[model samples]
Every structure is written in structure tokens, then in C-alpha cells.
Target: MTDRPTDLSSPPTPQPVRRSLLSARKFALMASVVAGLGAGLYGFSPAPDHFNVLSTAAHAQVNNEVRKVAQPVGFADIVERVKPWVISVKVNINEKVAKNDDSAEDSPFQPGSPMERFFRRFGGPDGMPPGLRGGRGGRGAVTGQGSGFFISDDGYAVTNNHVVDGADKVEVTTDDGRTFKAKVIGTDPRTDLALIKVEGGNNFPFAKLAEGKPRIGDWVLAVGNPFGLGGTVTAGIVSASGRDIGNGPYDDFIQIDAPVNKGNSGGPAFDTAGEVMGVNTAIYSPSGGSVGIAFSIPASTVKTVVAQLKDKGSVSRGWIGVQIQPVTQEIADSLGLKKADGALVAEPQADGPAAKAGIQSGDVITGVNDQPVKDARELARTIGGFAPGNSVKLTVIHKGQDKVVNLTLGQLPNTIEAKADVDRGDRGDATRGSDIPRLGLTLAPAGSVAGAGKDGVVVTEVDPKSPAAERGFKEGDVILEVAGKSVASPSEVREVLAAAKTENKNSVLIRVRSGGSSRFVAVPLAKG
Candidate 1:
């Protein structure tokens, strides 16, 4: 379209420009350039608040993505699915039975302490339930309560062995408020696991043990009866795995940060999939309350122990019959080993499987069935996993040579008695053995000491400031061997020490017998 501009009056009204000073396209372009320049200056300025505004938006986007994958909304659904399998275990013991049961005093508090009395008042001395501390002329029943869960549909349940260890009557209360009489089928004190059969029920809700071990930081739910309060549920993450808390030989426990109290023993710790990851057994609490650090027997251990308890009324563990110790770094160096990994044989039991198979003192057990043992504890656990009479190959470092020995496993006895004092035969002159000046020991023939055996030299005296004393040598300790050689007198010990020194050995390994037990000690040699 063409614009018509015609004016002749009043100087043509300044001739009202026939065209605008700038075209519409040029005006829009110039406005955009000015706006962009202002924005660039605002962004490049040293303003923390402005930068934080942009940073917060970026962080918000990242957090939204992370929350969608890593975090769970809640554990309610998992808890609901697993709670039905949890139950409360109650035991009634005759006063006579409770008195004879040593496990009845298995309290978290020290024996005879005031805290023990206080905790025992509510629960029994075992931290389960009520019991009679002392009463006159009456044999009243001592009642205890704990927690457990069904493991099969035929009313078979699992509980802590200590719960019904010597019970006269056992009762279980389910989540649905129904009570059933239960009989203890078998108990394993080593793992502290027990199997029981509930009467009056053929179909019971049971827990499925997790096929896979729970990983650290995985979410877990602990359900149990705490202080007679049944069906309590707590949520937390798996804090750690394969923990050894000095409970027993098999102390591989799964630690969780869930709040588990005294009465929660034997209850299952469930994973997000509603599978039992472990059984809540103990708490590391000083006040007998849930301090958020609790221990659970792994489901793998429970399954193994419960299976045996169900098949047989007693659990039998394979034993090699040897007193063992850790292969410390010093011991490793003394034995010419590259790594401090294995079990050092302190002494093999007389006529036992290991001794019968020619295993000797100071041998290091490095592996079983080609599986490397991490330490002395691992050796004990590996051997115990097998049944009695099972033959296996043991990789032993015997006399600085690696050899495999095949030995039949023996059954672990219920009570491992201390060996009797050896009848050492005749006496020798006390002055026959010379003093070991380097070790700061005054030696005498073991036969010279009135009650000491004749196998080695006796420590007549030990200088407190000497290397021997520092290595735990004391009077009455018999030195059985020095540098892998049997030492019968002080001269024999001196010869071995001289040989080790000439060989430039850093330390000499000595097997000593003290308090009816034997152990190997690596003593550092004095430098010239």
C-alpha cells in the first residue's frame, strides 16, 4: 500500500514525514540487541545471590532424578507382608530346671551387677521374661518370653536356642492373637538357633529366607516382640555384614541400624522383597534398650543350623582337634611366609584327626578344599561347616614346605575338657641348665621342677625387663621348643638361638606350654 502525504498549510505541518524515521523491522532488531546486552551484563556480574538462583534450579533438577531411582517412599508394604510370620515365644521352666541351666544367666549386664538385677526384674536373667530371683519353700515356674517366626507351612518355627533351652512348656503367640503350644525339637547352642514345632496348626504363614545376601546400605525391616510387646516393627538400613561380636565360634552376624531390644531375639529382619535377611539375636546396648546398633544371625546360618536341628535332635560339627591361633605379621615373617594369612597350629590334640594324620605343631593351615583361609577364625568356621567323617584336603605349610593332608573329620564334643597334667617321669639336677642371658631367662630342666613335665625346659625365673618376659614368658612356663627344635635343656635352647642368629633370622618361633595349654610365640632376636 502506498501512503499519500499532501500538506501545504502551515509549512505543510512540517511535511509530517512521508515515511517513519525507522522501518518496523529495524526498530524490532535494535530493541532485541539492547535487551541482550543488558542480560549479558547481569549474568557476568559478581553477585552470589544471582548465581545461586541459577545453581539452585540446576540442583533441583538433579535431585529430582536421583530421588526417582535411589530412595524408597516407605517400608510399609514390606513390613505388612512379613509381619504375619512373626510370633512371640514364651517358655515356662521349672525352678529346678532354671537353676541347672547355665544359659539362664546369659544377661547383657555383668553377673551380680545392679543393672543385671534391674533388667532381670522385668525379663528373666536371660533378658527374656519374668523369673524368680529368690523365693522360700516354693518351686514356682519361671516364665520367659522372646520372639520367633514360622519357617514352614507345617507349623515349624525358629527361635533362639537360649529361649527354650531347658523349658518345661513352650507356647507361641501369632500376630493374629492365637496361641499355640510349641515343642522344642532341637537346639544348637553354638549358633544360638533352635527349631520348634507348633501344635494345633497345619497351615501357618512362614517367612521365606532371602536367596541372596543383603548388601550394605540395603533397606531392612525388623519385626519382633520387645518387652512382651508383640508384632513391633522397626526400619533401618544394613549397616554392615560378616561381623564378629565374640558371641561364639560362628559369629558371622549381619549388623543393622534398626532398633532391636532384648525380647526381639530370634525375630526375622526382612528385606524390601519381604524375605528374611537375618534373625535379630543381640544388641550392643549398654542400657538394655535399643541403641540403634543390633546384630542378626544371617539367614544362611539360620537355614543351615535349622535344617540340621530338624533332621536330627542335635547339631554335629566337624572338628580337626587342634588349638589354633592367628598367623600374625611377626609370625608370618618368622615362618618365611609372604602374607600373614592362615591358622597357626598351636598344638594338635593327642590321637585326634590332625595329629593322627601327622599334622604337627607350628604348621600353618593355609586352605581347605583349595579355598584360602583368611585367618584362624576362618579355619574354624570352614572345618565346622562339614559333617563328621567327611574327608577333605588341608593345605598346610609344614616345616616350610607346602603339603596337602587328607584327614577324616571328627565330631566336636559337647564338653572339650582340658587335658590332664602329663606324668613327666623322673627328676634331673636343677643346675644342669645354664641361664639364657639374651632372653633374660633362668632355665631349669622340666624334670628338675617338682610338678613340671620332662618334655622341655622350665622358666625358673624371668627378668621383667627382658624380651622373653615381654613376650609373655613367666615363671612355671615350660619352653617346649626353640626354633622348631625340641629343647630339653638350656644348652639345647642356646644352640637353636645361635643357629637362628647365624641364619640372620629376625625372630625365632618358640612353642610354650602354660596353664595346660600350648601356643607359639615369635620372639624378636636382639640385634648385634
Candidate 2:
């Protein structure tokens, strides 16, 4: 029938069962061959030792020198050890008084500024919740919470200065949920540290400060009262050290990545060893919450400030009595210094210790007591570290000459104003402006100008496009000194400029006095 007309389109189906049996037989043969090979390899391989699973022969092909790393478990042990020492501090502050009182200085940050937000004192009146703030015209006393830890057995504890500042009543609740009335022993506003004495306890659990500085990347545990939640714990690492956040002159804060929030101020950041690494004081936040950037006063600073606060009710720091600025490369080049370092004396205060010890405005303080002065801030911190009336040997670079001046530091006053400002009176018809060669300045004698004092030449006009203007010279700026020499007339400045050019100097250093302060400017000497 298939050959009759051809169902030629359909192929023949033949021996399906036989083909299947052949394929099964071939797969079975391949399986047997693989099994035989595996058995042979197993017979040649050495048997694993039951007693010594990690023997040398077992790992002969592996690199034994590779270190096996494991993840850290958790900070639970550290938290358990240090949690007993943490306390929640409650302060009753009159919001109306805190807003108007001079106690605002107790806070390093302003009340309503962005820095206030960045470094907001958690227990301060502004840091409290809106509901907790005074309800009726903001005139009632409001309560706020902060964090603190006991430092001694006799109920002596450490908290933030802002926490106890202007407090009508101070109280602390321990980890055990017991509240005690505490009194502020002392407070240091400069460092924002405070010492308080908790009543009704003689033997309390305490925490020890870490002996050395916490290294960056070291695991840290922050224990505190965050958002009124007592004994809250967060984990992170030490982000940095010696950070200056413009808090104050002595702003050597340890930056941490711990999630510290409001009410965490005055808390303790502990190391893995359960020792206090720093006291959490401020946080850098844009939305008024922790963004993983928090600042703490290092244990070193806390030790020093707390010691002083414990001794007396106030803190006194050493002051050199000089207005200083960082030494820039331009200033170094103009002054023939090989390296730009140390602090430049912008102006030594009148009758100040630095002025009395022969320190001049043009001098550069290179070192203090044999230690290098890193910058203006370092010099301030170094001097402040010493007690008042302490003798200090200052290495100074005065007018290109290196000299050591021995001076006793004075007590930093509660209120130390910055450098005095120059009184630039009404720019009446000053003397006709005179031009200096290669300098874009129209100068006039200070005595000829009505409001300008008779100490230096006054800048009648500055070419907006000139090097002088670019160097921060303003029309009313008084040129106090040119090339280390005081100038009273335009001719004196010209003479100094000519002399500097003759000496093949690329720039001339001039001390300029502006509205309220004096600073040195290095003006480039354009070639004729």
C-alpha cells in the first residue's frame, strides 16, 4: 500500500524498542567505566585521618600561610560592662531666661545658627522637643534630658557643660532606674565639659577613661540617652581625631561614626575594652538627626578639663596674648622662610604677655617649649594646655631672624576679644592719591586722612584688577608696614617696594589693617 502511490512523505518507523535498549546499554557501559575510574582514583588517594582532620597531608595543596579571617561577634560584652555607669541627666531650665540670659555663652554654639544645629547641646532648652518647650509664650520652665557617666565612686559624674548650664534643678537617673538630685560642681564653657555630684549614693559604678587615644577604625560603642531614651547603645568606629569644628578656640574633638542624636550629649563613647574613649558632645546633622557623624571630646581633653573643673568652679587656660593666623606659603615666601609653618603673629595685644616678651606683629611663632607650633590653633591649644604663669620658651622668626623669647603665659580671661579693629573714619577728601611703580595702589599719608590714624599710610584707592586688590587690599585699608618696616607715607612704601625689588624678591609682605582686624598680605612685585 505504501508503494502504491506513495505515502512517500512519511518515513518508515522501525525497531523503536531495539534502539531504546541499545541506548540504555551504552549509558550503562559509560556509567560503569566512570565508576571504575573513580574507584581507581580513590584507591590511590590517602584516606582522611579521623583524629587529625587538619593534618599537613590533608591540605598539602592549600596555602597554610593564608590567614583565616572572621567577623567580630558584637559589642554586647562592652555594652554590658559600661551600661551600669551611664545615667540620664534631667535639667529644669527656664526657657525665657535661657533664651535671654548670658548663659548662652555656656554653649559653644549660637542658639539659632546652623552651627547650633550641628553642635546642639542635647540637654539645652533649644534641644528639647517642641511639646516640652514652654507652651505659654515660651515663659515656663522646661525639662530636658542628656547623658552622663560616673567617673568616681563618691557619686562624682561627668556630663556636658550645656546640660548643667543655667539649670534651676539638676537630676540624674541611673541605669537601675533610680533618680537622684544632682548638683553642678563645675562647668567649663570653652570645652563644654561639666562635673556634677549626684547625691544619695556613695558607692556607684564608674567607668575609666581610655589611657591612650583611640585609633581610627577601632570599634566603638556609644552609650547614652538618645531622644530621652536612657541607656541607648549604638556602634561605630573612630572616624578621626583632632577635628576643629569651629566650636571654640580649643576645638580638638574626636569624630566618630556612631549614631549619636540629641540627648546623647555628655554620653560616653567606649572602646572594645569598655573604657571611655570620648564624651559625646555634638553631632553634625542637617535634619537635626544623627547622620553618622558625631563629635566627642576625647578622654584626654575630658581628663584635663574635668580635673580643673573638679578643683575649682571655673577653668583657667594659659594665654600668650597674641592675635595669630596660619602661616601661608605666600607669607613664607615674602618673609624668606623655607617652609610655611607655625603661627604668624598678626598683632600682639597691647600690654599682653607676648608684647611684653618682645614678640612683634611681624614675628612667626615656630615653636613653643621645644614643641613645634603646627598652626595658630595648635599654638593656642599648646599654650592653653599649660597653667597660667608657667614659663614658656617660644621659638620665633622675627623679620627673618630666628630668636627664642622666654615668656610667662597669662591667665586666659573669661572674655578675650580678638585683634583690635582699625577705625576707618569717613573717607573725607584725603590727600591726593600717589602711585607706586608696578603696584596698583593709590596711597596717601594716614595723617593727611581725617579718619585714618597716623600709624601707617592709607590706601586711597586700589585698582580692582591689580595684584594689590587681588591680595585683599581695599581702598580704605591702611598699609601698616611694608617689607617689615612701618610706613607713614606713600614715599616710604615706594622706597620699601624699590628695595625689595632690588633685593630680587618676587613679592613684598605688607601688614594691612582693615575695619576691625590686621593681617599680612603678600603682594606680587610685577616686573617693569
Candidate 3:
């Protein structure tokens, strides 16, 4: 035991410990080499051929080509050329003065006068005290600014009708700081266009109208005075064409994605070639600022309206007097039409061109001068493009027969008389109809219902989900005719329905009268 204690101070077994340390170092070195080899392979190896390498390269090249084609290089040259012809239109409106004898006791604004309401709504002008308004006699000058462009070398300019309307004095300022008094040559409110001329200048710089319409996605340059900042230039592409903003009957507007503001109205929207493609008229903005949605009058419409305004100081549009509605799919099916196209003639005026040309109610106008009309609005615009007293041919479908009619157009009237309301007397007694239930309608003689006349069959009850109800038939509606035949009793409706079924028809046209107006409704024979 003593000998073993003595040996504890010496170093123990060096050979076995050194061999174990060497084995641990060798394991770590081998692991580092394997990791380095794996990283090198991952970083330096080529992509496999089966991984669609060729297709990926092809897609990259195509995308690069598309980027090159779509991106515009510069618009400075176009802006510089078109900016000279653009002008700023300033108008001074002289408001009528109300007579006020007493300045201290009487307020200049009456209790319910427009000026009083205006002050209440928007405060006094320039933040002036309301009491001081009485001494001014309610007379004030309103200043308005807009944009326009020269159309002729003799200083004829084109702008919007709303720009200089009711203006006492109009002044136009060019890009070169020259200002001149301008006079209105003419205005067309229907098209929202105006023509004006400057007297003191000749050989002035002018812009040319584009020969063709700009296609969708074509680059456009809009130069205008936005928010009174003169000669502001913006660039965008044509977003759409033939847009209707419900402004007027001739509402074919070219929609663009340009940053247009309040003072940009009546400015010119130029094409890449520096030609005037459209006249900027309105913007579809929610915050009273540009949201990249703007509308312009197309060059085609501008050209025609300008020519008329220059010639006669007014625009005279052709009129074929007929009340029209859209041809629905149900209507087309009832009339045996292959597609739902054209305008349905709801009514022809008594002595108008349509009546003289033998056009009748329920006829569909399919074409004008052999050009296919897409809808009622298209037919209206097409006819309006022609001059009054021009002879035109109309292709119409009457009683399921296609016919051509020649008509000499008349001048469109400035005012159209509203349809008079039919006076309905009290109904007498109740008369019940047979319980057929196929059309899901309960009918009776018009005389049976209160305030229903004796001319047509009255709809007494209608199922909520029925075909007749789906076609907009109500409980008080009176069926005036079925398939152009007058129906005085419920039996006539059944007769027409039975005849349509025999002819393998899916729907039938029924003329219904509700309140004071009458319209044609096609009811489907299918059940829900």
C-alpha cells in the first residue's frame, strides 16, 4: 500500500493518452475537408440541362425586350413643341347687383338670396365681415381660369363651352407672356365645346388635329394650366375610348390616365407626334385631385363640332324622332333574333321623321346607312352626326321581318315635351280570372281594379319568384297588348301564351302600362 502511494506523484501512462488525442484531431480534420468540398460543389457546379435552363433564359430575354419596348425614352421634345400653342383662358363674371338703398340698416344679402346662402355656406369673400357686404350693393367680380389651344393661324382657339360661359370679358395669355382680348365665336353646349378668336394677331402658332384616333395604351402628352400653374405638362397612356360620363347626348369621351386638375379643363391632350388628339374636359376624382382618371372629348368629335361652330355659330344635329330603349336578351328571344343587338323603338312621334318614314313602335333599328348599330346610344350618335335634311337609310326589324326604310332627317328640337300622365278613374267591381298558375299571375279586367281603366287586363296578383315578376310586372300593371294584339281580358293573355307554346317560342312580348308610361316587356315561358 505504501509503494502504490509513492507512485502517484509521477506522470501516468503517456502513450495511450497521446493516441486518443491524435484520433480526435484526425476526426475534426476529416469533417472540415468534407464540409469544404460540399460548399465548393454547391457554389461552382453548372445548372442541370433538365432543369429548364433554356426556357428560363428565353423568358428573361423576352422580359427584357418588353421592358425596352414599353418604357418611353423622353417626352421633353413633345412638350416643348406643344406648349407654345397652349393658352390660358381667364374670364371675368360680373354678378348682377341687387339694389340696396340703406347701407347701415339693410344687409346687402336678402334672407333667402343666393348671396346670403353663399355667405352662410362658404363665409364672406376674402374673409371679409358679413356686415360690410351691405355697402357693396351685392355686385362682385368672379375670376375663373382654364386652358385652351389655338386651332388656326388667324388666332382661332378651341376650348370647353363651360369655360367661358356667361363671361363678361375673356382674356387669353400665351406661353410667351403675351395677353390679348378674346371673343367667343360660337359654343355648342350639347358637345361641351367652344370656339373663340383673338383679334390683334395673325400667323399665330397653332396645333394640328390628329388624323387618326389614338389607340389604347398609346402615349399621350397633356399640357395645361393645372390649378392656375401655367404650362404644366403630364404624360400618360390612353386608358379607354368611347366613354360616356352622362354629361350630354353626344358623350363619347376618351379616357386617359393623366394627372389633370381643376384648371386643366379645355386643355389639349397631344399625341406623340405633337398633334391634338383630344380636348381634356373632366376628371373622375374623389378628392378633387388627380387619381389618374381623366376624360377628354375625342378629336373626331372635336373636329365635327368645331366645323359647325365656325360655320353657323351653332351645332345642328339630325333628328329622327323616336323614343328608344335597349333591346334586352328576353326581347331578342321573343322577337326570334339571333343576338341581342340594336335599339327598340318604344314610340314614334306623331308627325316626326320616324312616323313619316313608316317607323312604328316595337321596331328595332339594327343599322344606320348599312353600318351596324350596337345599341340605342350608338344609333343616336350616328344619326346626330349627319346634318339636318340629310337622307339616310335605316335597317329595322318590324313584326319579325327585316325591312329598309329611307328617311329625311329633321332638325333636332331644342326642347322635348314630356309625356302626359293618363288620368285613371275609379274601378267598379271585382272580376276573377281562371287559376292557370303557369305564368304565376292573377289577372282581371282593368275595370275591376281601383283606378284601372277599361282598356287592358290588370295584374291583380304576382308571385314573387315568377317569370312575370322577374320581368318587372307588378300588381297594378295593366297588360295593354300581347304580341302586338290588344288584350281586353285575361283570356287573351292565355291565348297568346298558348299560341307561343304551339310555335315553340320561349318567350312572348307584352306591352304593359304602369302609371302614366307604357313599355314592352318580354316574359319568359320557363318556370322557376
Candidate 4:
């Protein structure tokens, strides 16, 4: 190749240096970074707008988690803070002998000799389980251990109804180790709350109910006895709220992941602020241990029940006598609702509140006194809080437009009562119909089912393995009608089924309200 340096002398001009085509890319990236910083600084949202954004924290980018931090209450401090008021409940109930009488088996308590056996037979517990007590020999004390806390300094404490049900003698043990005789003043089974008073207590440690919306992922604590281990404390966040565990009508449970178990019933669920937001009551456990599905009854529910118990020594529900169901997406769509929203009025009592206000079946209630009804539980809680003759404005989803109806909520007859009053319907079987009847059924009132307003038939029982049982009939499932016949009680379902038996039918058209949604199902009827 010929040397070009020879021409360099003549040209004496510098050649232009080559540059990368990607140089613009670097500048663009820097510009983007700067613009991002500027936008963020100037209040431009940095979040990706999303539906689920409500559930996550925005500071997660920096690994900063959203924590529920209360006003720094210590475990013993909280125990010392709320303990003298915290109480232990002891319940006693004669274990019912199954109707299909079976001979008492060989039990440890059986007399060792004929004389002992005779003595045992003489003093056998009247209502006692096998082996626990000498048969008819002595009165048995069914010891049930659970939790509670005082709301007032005058010795008023609150616990779950399950804690006090069938209690012959309730002895409340305080943190100070003083056990006093406690008696249930009033119990609202709908809310699973009971008001109890202990003798010889004053200036007791008490906790005030916290009032606010619970934040998901907020640091919270549960204090109670677990497995009979007293003064146990567990921490977690709010997993959910207003959760209906099919427990009762007033089922606005504050769902948390805190470890609560068999003996932790009726403990307080405290926020970081040391305020009682809920009462620890339940867990979704498949193995009798904490499975991160613990639930608490919210303080709002507590407040209502407490006021009722204090004023009347019983809960007096404001009844707008009307039957209603949850407005499911399907029913909402049928009614032209944008979302499966509000409570659908299925039936109304002739002289109940809704009927007096001229409310009718098919009116979807969206709110009570401006409180929006998101589900049947919301409606039930709302109605439950009202006293008889207390007028409330109920928003109805009628046809399409939201209509406001002024109804003076009235007190319903105590014919139907809190599940605690049911005397035989508070346990797990209270949730299924078959538990009540052989088809594996149990029964509850329609209004009691979702706590939604109702004036129609309540389907409370369906037998397991029965044609109705196999088709998913549950205890809380409110039977609206059977084969076009209106039903209002478990007795009605029995009557309708009995009548259907006479007819040659393989299936019966059953209209029921489940999870607030009303639907018709062709339940298999017993073959004639």
C-alpha cells in the first residue's frame, strides 16, 4: 500500500474522529433518569395504576414494608394494662346422651366393685359424659376455659358466647390471680359476644375499643389463653375484615393471622395503638392449631352488643320485617346492577318495618341510614345496631336507580334469638342443615343466616346423604320457598319436604339464600 503520509503534508487537515451510533442511547437514558426523578419529585405518581394496588404498599420498592405499629404496648404491660379485667370463663353442660340409647361402656369411673358400682349408680351425674364422672354418682362440672376482658372499672367484662354457654358456674381468673364468681349478664350470639360481671371487682384493668378501619398488614396482637396456657400473646397483621365465617348474622369478623386456638376464645385483638379493635374468637384450622386463619369479632360489633346488654341485658334487634338475600353477580346482572351489590329483598313481613314503609320483595337494599351495604353481613350488622322505632334510611337498588327509603326499624319478636339462645345450635353443626336432621342438616333463621334483613322463610336444616343433602344444602342456607310455597323456618322445610314426598317427584325446586345470594336449585327430593 502506498503511504498516505506524503499527502498529509499537503492536506495538513485532521480527519474527523468516528463516534458510536449508540452515543444517543446513553444521552437518552440519562435524560430518562433525570425526567423520572423530576416527575417523582413533582408529585407525579410513580405507581403503576392497578386494581390490586390497594392491597400492596408503595414503599415496597425500597423494601420498606407497611407495618401495623401501635403505641408500643408490651406483652406483660398489656397484660398488666388489661389483665385484672381479663377473665377466665368456666362453663358446664350435661353432655346429652344420644337418642339412640346405648349402654354405658366400660369407663374408668366405673365402680371397681359391685358396692362401688351401686354407689356410682346412686350418685351418677345427671348430665355427664362417660368416664368423666361416676355414673349418676356425683354432679359433674364441665370445665370450659376461655378468655375475656373488662370494659368498665365496675367489673364488666366481655367474652364470646361460646365461652359462657351452658355455664353452671363461671369463675373469672384475673391477672392478679384472684378468681371471682362470674356470671353472664347478657349474650348476643349473633355477634358471638357476651357481657359478664364478676362479683367483688372494682377499678379493674380495662381496654377501650379502637374505632377505625383496620389496615391490611398492620401490626396487631392477640392476647388470651391458648391450649389453656394463660396470658399468651401472638402477633400478626390484619388478613381481612368484615369476614363472614358463616358464624352468624352479625359476622363482621376481623380476620387475622395471629395464633389463636381452642382456649383463646374471647380474647382481645389489639392494634399497635393498644386499642381493642376486635375480640379474638376463631381460626380456620384443619388440624386444631393455628393455620393463619384466625378471626376476631370487630369492636364495632362489640360496641353494639355491649350497649344492648348493658341497657336491656339482651340484644334487641331492629327488624324491618323483610326477607332478603345477598345480591350476587348473577342476580345483580339480572336486575341491571353494575356490580353484584346490595341486599336483595325477597320477602317482606306484613307488619314489619319494611312492610310498614311500603318496601316489597325484589327491592335491593344498598345502604342503611347511608351506610353502604356491601354484603348481607353489612346489612345485618346495620340492622342489628338499630333499636326498635329507630328510623333508618335504607338505599334500595330498585329496577336500576338507587332509591332511598325511610324505614323506622322495629323490634322483632324474640321468637328467633341469638344463636346462643338456640340452646342446641352454636357448635360446628349450627352451620350445616344435615346436623339438625338425618340428611345431615341444621337450621337457622333466614335473617339470622347472613344477618341480612328478612321477612320470609328461613331454611335451617338439610340432611346429609339425603337427596337435599347431596345437593349442597347447608345449615345457614335460608330456604326462601319450596316449589313456590313460601317457607320461613326449618319446620316449613320439613312440611314442604313431607308434602313433596306425597307427590311423585324426584327433585324439588328450592329457592335458597346462600352467602347473601338467592338462587333456585332443583334439590333432590326423597323418593316417594
Q: What is the C-alpha RMSD of each candidate to the true structure, in Å?
A: 14.0, 11.9, 16.3, 18.0
Worst 10 residues of 2 by lDDT: 61-70
How many steric overlaps are in each model, in order?
Answer: 1, 1, 0, 41
Where does candidate 3 stray beyond 4 Å?
1-72, 95-141, 420-479, 489-491, 512-519
For model 1 the local lDDT of residue 223 reads 91
Best by TM-score: 2
What is the C-alpha lDDT profile of model 4 across 163-275, one tens digit per residue? 67656667778776778887789986566679999898688878899988788888788887666666777888999877766555666778899877667788888887778
lDDT (Cα, tens digit) per residue for candidate 1, span 200-311: 8988989999888999999989898887877999999999998876655677889999888767888889998999999887676655577788888898888888889999
- Each model's lDDT comes to 0.80, 0.80, 0.77, 0.64
- Cα displacement (angstroms), candidate 2, residue 426, comes to 2.0
User: TM-scores for all candidates?
Assistant: 0.77, 0.78, 0.72, 0.59
Pairs in steric clash, model 3: none
Better of 2 and 3 by TM-score: 2
By summed lDDT, the worst window of 10 consecutive residues in model 4 runs over 127-136
